[model samples]
Target: MSVTDRPVPSHDRIARAAFPRRRVLQAGLAAAAGAAVLQTTAPAEAAMRREGWIRSRIARMSVEQQVGQLFVMRVYGNDATASDNRNMNEYGVASPAEIVAKYHLGGVIYFAWADNLPTPAAGARLSNGLQRAALAAPGKVAVPLTISTDQETGIVARMPDPATVFPGAMALGAGRDPELTHDTYEITGAELRAVGVNNDYAPLGDVNVNPANPVIGVRSFSADPALVAELLVAGVNGLQSQQVSATAKHFPGHGDTDVDSHTGFPVIHHTREEWETIDAPPFRAAVEAGIDAIMTAHINVPALDPSGDPATLSKPIITDILRGELGFTGVVVTDSLGMAGVREKYGDAEVAIRAVEAGVDQLLNTPAADVQYNAVLDAVRSGRISRRRLDESLVRILGMKYDRGLHRDPFVDESAVDEIVGNATHKARAQEIADQTITLLRDDADLVPLPAGEVLVTGYGDTTTVNLAASLSDHGHPAQAFVTGSSPSQTLINSAVTRSAAAAVTVVLTYGADTNTAQQQLVQALRDAGRKVVVVAVRNPYDIAGLGDTPTYLATYSWLSVSTEALAKVLAGEIPAAGRLPVSIPSQADPDTELFGFGAGMDN
Candidate 1:
């Protein structure tokens, strides 16, 4: 039967069915309690049953197996044990399946380059194979593996062609409807669940305060703490409602830094009060909403933790702030261990031990799974990491597996992959989201209903521009696309200008023109040539500050196909531009002044 043949049941019903109490326990409850007590107390009893089951499972696990449960490792393979895949052979195993069994792994993460997601069916097959290996591991270590991936929709999606390509967080923020955010994530969770991925590392909780932020630009929902918090709660509720665990990531915020943590260490000097007001609200909201997991950021905040350790390895940050102050009882997982943000301060073994010591429940994507496994094992044996500490994380990890229904059935029907992934309903919703996120900031020349003639679409990338042209042509607009590289050479600019002279209207897409003088030059040159130009900021809306005087200007927070296609329909007069800016566009001369304030949008 098709996975979407009927309406999806609520998460409460699904969880109850997946982790039902024993028949004896059910009978005992019926016999011991009056109907009124059972009616009011069933939820409490259910929680006790889940905790009891998790404890029983953990009690059976050996020390080696318990240590393994702390790490969520990654391997390179589509099949169980392909000889061609050798990225993880350091574990004395050739295939991912072999490694899962050899280490008695608690979970595995999928990455595109790891050859783990060629197709939806292949993903299901790989997940099933991994689950089988984990379940059949030796000596009381058999449990289902919690399969996961960074399917955060916009910029970080791993699944190809058939998966619904929804816009990124900034786009959704522009749409500015909490219920829309919820529905979009529900579709995202449904697709991931259909393919057997039980966990999603998504719904960023960062408040992007710095306009110069390098990494968390379009990934953030908005710059306002209250807005980000509102969307985050909706996203968490939406995703978990579909039975796939939702992870609110980069706790303590990665927003104000100009440096990319993946490459360098970033230090945020937000005072305790500033941190509490600007960055901590969304995470507090996620915890209040019962988020399944919270991923730690690798950035350092001196005001919060004077120890100078990154949040991923800082007891004060992870344990004191997140667990104690915020009262988060869910799993606390680290960002990838291989990123330079975490690695620059410590070695591999030290990183693993410190993360566990700092109260991180799961270590993600360690450089070498075997090294981390051995280090953690030795730490536990030597009491550097207490037995209580090891079991504490183990219980959270195991409990999440049971709650997400991974332990009940960790496999997906491969046959249903084609039916559910990128289906018509999901695609239409994606397009609708894209439509709502197209913010038309200005149209002074009133060239929106493009003057009737051939349209010239030129942009920084060939794929991006060509796709926009294709989408335009599909919208019955006669359009031709030209590629102007990020740093467009004078030659490419001259060619695009000459082509623009023959067209009635020219639509130019800018990517990071704010700092790229070459791109800024290209936009000015077109305006200097007296061509009818409409500028669209596709990557960063800050691009608008550079070309602010253009007669017609727009911002689509993402350059993904869904977003560009929505831009095409709007340009073709098929749909109206209805999105508001989620972040303010600061004036170039004075960063404190807004060239285009937040919530700026003009309809055609």
Candidate 2:
């Protein structure tokens, strides 16, 4: 029979079947037998009731269905169209509906491709269709799926337009206001929930200590563990308050490594003491703050586990360290298993089995869900992994789903998506965060609050640069733009220099100039040409050291439109540079020498 043709089970029926009165009575009687001796604890009785329900549900599930509950597969949101369906089927990728119906997946994660719907209404319709499929799957105990996305506000946002874009974590940290951080995440959660995403992989707790760290640069809150912890907890509260699960990610810290775990395993040699001091504090705080989930990092910490296994597949790390030492009772989810860090070492099947045995409750983004599911089922049948162990994770997963109220109403209101997403208030709050987070690192020439005169804006012609020019012009500064590539050709630089000669002040925008020599050279050439240059590191603050004697420097931390507007306001003296550096800036001559400390920002 087709999955769609199957009869759907009512929520009450599933609930009653999951927690049978007979079993509940049996457990209650046993508890009551000891009630006089133990003084009848309501909490204990409630726990027993929950355990009975989970056990009854597992007892009713087929092996395949039970194993499927452990996997959260990635699905395309664009699969509602015939063309997308054809392409997905040709590529052997199942539609979101098909995956939920066939595999009975525990959850679905929306990627950028899936989330590129025409509007919030379209996204809501797609999400509702997927949930309906899960509900219609042929099963006695059909549970609703947990829908999720990487809606981390700035660069990592998966949901397309109509979702307000806030500054990244580093910029939030620069703002140095926990209340603002909470409100930002609360809005992020509300928008995601409006579009039917229940889980958010965000508030990255990594304390980015290594300036050269490629992947986690601006995604992290700060280099200081204490500050990151304070802000991370606020972020957690905000998301949970909005009825979305917040995941404190890259467990035990992925911030110090130079290698990208997406491609390879980065080894951190920090001892237990070192880790406790630097890498573990944010996670510890997250556990205490009641973070819903903790995503494991693919990097290997030798001190934590001598087996050289990454935390995603290490029992000692996930179970002993996070669960035991930190006392985190929430779900433990794996980073994507498709990443080379895990895939290259262990095949999909082995990785799934190992992750389960290592105490990971959810297997995320596996290369092939069917293969992993079958492999886990085979392990269970062969006694390689006990069904009891499987049940442990299943209980937690189901408990979270129930707690999220998915069973009662998994679908979102399609009309509400448009109403809640990117509303006026959210956009204003985003602009406010951007305005407050502009850090003035260097202003030796007192070039800011420029006297009424013509201004030259030159950059790679990115969105941020275009917005900056428009914002300046709007603020009555006659601004002319000199556009260039991210790595501008000499001709472009020369042209910009010639254009700058006519303006009272030259504003050169840079992205990753600390690493990109071309960006550094362009700034140097403008300086050498004797243009009064004010450099803004739009992406990374590390560019300050690379600009080579620029008279003025500022850190916008991101290139979002709001950030660009804020930059214009700060430059025009309409808004004070109130933000501080979240991470220290290293000297160009000596990497060890601190050129600017973490709280260093000046306001005129």
Candidate 3:
């Protein structure tokens, strides 16, 4: 689907289109009605105009309280340790529940640690804990609390024990499968909503314009801007279908840089015309499709704002372009206040104040609550920014809270969260995607089937690959799987070379893009041992730049254990290799070159 496939229609038209797609029967205010509501509802009294006592009971607040509705800072649970405290201090708060209660804060984004006892039933329990805390203190009126989470596939996921993972967005785009994209994201959203996650900052619409981009490499849908726009729209629509709010993020683009925007500032140099042409397409498509939110990029776009600050602080980009030109009247959010792109340069208090000045509806991952809150209060008192602007942002945030039905009721079914999270269906669907997206980019020697002799398998030490090895016992071969990572005094490549001599074909597998040293060691080991190394380029192909003399090679651009097992079957000749490279896997020394284009592969 091209950008022109659907002209940027009005929000009413988009809502009409989206209503049929949604299972909910909720009627929303039209633009005119919303504008009228904004005009008639006073800053201190919008909560009282026409709402019922139950909704008005807790949903309305003063202008100051309304502005407070726009900041969704990161939070930690009660069991946080020293490291957790340090991490939170960098950008989040120590006790989020208390902050929400006192400040009447809008929402909390959970960046829960890897081993924080994730369970399907935990989502609601955690949400209820936060909600109860947030509602402890009544506002001048009353307002509900909002909770959100980042459950992107394979990265920062929070699926409970029984849950499975689908291929990330890039794999779906690489496979050129829209049905798969729609189905996978829909399942993901269902799983999230079942457990009480209302907002999902996903379907990374940013095109992977830069292959070396540290953050967005495999998270993006495709390198082609057009395809990213198309598949991303489908992905967002799929998520929205499940009643979960889908958000397009890293606005103005994040896929064209090698540096990590989280730790450093990277600049995009697209011209104004190019912005209209390239970077803005995905976001514009989402808004036209009635997407709930758009998250600002931390990276600087020189053309959008020459001030060198990220788009999060630039009015020309956020207000003038995003709000004015693009006609996105929905919530506009910042990525995270603590990200180095903005934080290393701006003050905590100033970050919150400037973001609002830029017309943002939500301040993500706030730095210091005390500093940020005081700065906003100072800005309001000093007349630097208006009560109207604050109220304007707050109204949208309140609308979202109302839409979430928090205003009508400020509680989650804490007891119900466990039943819905990480259940059988969720895991099965994740496994299905894991199996489906597992591709076969290379199989040059057709030396699969293992010949029933010595077999060698290896990949990341993480949970996925370890599970693959455990599952591979069914293949009827003597298999040895090694862990891949940067090790002390020893490397994965060195270990692979040493072990390759004893195996028939070193069926090497790797997950995640950063595990390169292990892959290199495997290639070198294969060459030195004179073994048939049927290499599998999992995840980002950018990792395996040099594979020495390995005649047999495969690309299964994923690390899911199910996919890894499927690849093992392909190697064992149980199934024909039907997958191909969604992205090019370049050779060694030619780190700048691509061996094959997207969709390049061999099959039966």
Candidate 4:
């Protein structure tokens, strides 16, 4: 039976009743009698070969429905009554299926927590629910949506329960091997897809040009352009291997800026040549390697696009440099419009209108989705944004969806997910990568694998060196651990100096960051004690500048559990340290190491 002749399903009636805004708009999208609007045409970029049912359905959508596919709206996770109750209570956009149909939402980007799904059986159940929501569309296939999430490891933990947490970008950066980076992303992508996630906005390609930068911190892989590029390639290949598209982010460059774009405009002060040589290399490499998506940052690059608008809506940057100069043909997407960098400057509709005019293909986390839609429609009506441009972007977006076979029967295989979700092979890969990436900066006198010594451990932040100290103690060595939330307190320093005076060794883990006021003080503290100081950088490799030559130095580059275990193994001489410095270490006097040469290494 034809779709119209078939009785209206309960879901259609409910969605139509709940979202009159959508029903009235899409009532005319069908080819049947009583249709109020233009019938759907073949999806702008609908898969050229797939004859799947969903593909056929997408091919039938009208222009408006095709345009709808460019949007990716955020949704809170549900399926568990407790989760549903909590997230739904916080955000009103509950009942994802109805919301999908009502809003004409192309896809649902769920902010999820899966820590509760401990067993394979439990994970499959939840993955199925999310997949159902992703495939939900009232009476249409041209309206097929793309589900996405920020699964960038430690930077943003999705599920603290049910899922294993891998050390994030910083940890991978410390390992300094593209292959390890590859395995890291592969594992992350596999787990995400197994849980029904289709897009991972990850593998942050920023060069991290500033050490004091609060947010990016160790999140960046390295300061070296070449290393970052190779890592980006590995990350892309790994994610795509699992069919989870990874997005390389912060287009022009977000590394040099010290300001957090989420709260303010981050100014990238490098010249055109500087950007091309360093900050832009990784992104360029990712694009060349056929990365599926590119997300623009909200930061301002004065030299590249001085129009004062964020790259998200800047034509010169997105169209002129990104599309024109760089030769990137992939989808050009915008970061969240809700971020302060964009919202503080442009109104929601205006932001949406400009992004399209600037050649953006997808809109992520737009606050007023309908407002942006209406504004784009108005621009089309006013001849402000050319219909050709709109169609062009829509075609690119649709083409990707079609390639993914989203046009026909887009649901993920629920039963098959259990086998792939947190698979043993993936975890083993992570462990192997971790084993190879840990760096031993200064292993003087082969002092490591110490026969026996009373060791005193201290560092920045709240995370104590209790674990490291315990790891040392198991070898029949006496050890003590002390921790503070802030950078080393005066009392902690005094206590550490006194304790070190009588100890065989002192191992300090700095939890705060690379550039700090403690560099000079740390050196003085160790000199006063005349102790063998072993400083392990748990944040950024460049942070080791604080240690000087006072004692031994090691940079784990991240505080993730894997890297920690790796460091423990290195101290125990379980594996030879093979990780080279992915980025340069700043000179002892220069605490900010913005430019570090890649492949800097030393043996244990």
Global local distance difference test of model 2: 0.81
Ten residues in a row with the worst lDDT in model 3? 1-10
Report the C-alpha lDDT of model 3 over 315-434, residue by residue, as the tens digit: 999899888888888788888787898886677888888888998989887767767876787798788878778767766666666655565565546565555555577666655555
Ranking under TM-score, best-scoring first?
1, 2, 3, 4
Q: List the residue pairs that clash in candidate 1.
A: none
Which 10 successive residues of model 2 have the least lDDT summed? Answer: 1-10
For candidate 4, report its TM-score: 0.81
TM-scores of the candidates in the order shown: 0.93, 0.90, 0.83, 0.81
TM-score of 2: 0.90
Q: Model 3 reaches what TM-score against the true structure?
A: 0.83
Highest-TM-score candidate: 1
Name the better of 2 and 4 by TM-score: 2
Question: How displaced is residue 265 in candidate 2, in Å?
Answer: 1.9
Per residue, candidate 1 scores C-alpha lDDT tens digits across 114-183 of: 8898888888888988888888765655688888899887887888678999888988888887767888
Q: In candidate 1, how many Å is residue 258 off?
A: 0.4
Off by over 4 Å in 1: 1-36
